[model samples]
Target: MCPRRARCFNTTGPCSPQHHYMLPPAQRLPEARELIEMDRYFVLHAPRQTGKTTPP
Candidate 1:
């Protein structure tokens, strides 16, 4: 896993060097689940063309 600035890839949409955010579903979902179980609010911010959080 990277402990530094995440490398990014270009997609068929607006993108910039600053929009370096990306994560695997395998990685992000568990973190979301933990926060939900604890009743803590959090935001899912990702780069263009990524998952949209919906309440399960």
Candidate 2:
């Protein structure tokens, strides 16, 4: 099997969940991965530039 490397930080806009560290404010709070894994519908709110689009 091929090994995988950590994703790099983005310099432009929002980042993928795998690159959460790039947007520290959007870290795994309220258990983002867990919530998503549940397959339930939900929503999140945050100010602009606070990683609102990155699942914070």
Top model by TM-score, which number? 2
Query: What are the per-residue Cα lDDT tens digits for candidate 2 across 1-56?
Result: 11256666443465665653554543645576676799966677765555556433
TM-scores for all predictions = 0.35, 0.38
TM-score of structure candidate 2? 0.38
Worst 10 residues of 1 by lDDT: 47-56
Query: Which clashing pairs does model 2 show?
Result: none
Task: State which candidate has the highest lDDT.
Answer: 2
List residue ranges in candidate 1 displaced over 4 A.
1-26, 54-56
For each candidate, the alpha-carbon lDDT, in order, equals: 0.54, 0.55
Off by over 4 Å in 2: 1-12, 16-21, 25-30
Q: Tell me the number of clashing residue pairs for each predicted model.
A: 0, 0
Q: lDDT, candidate 2, residue 31? A: 72
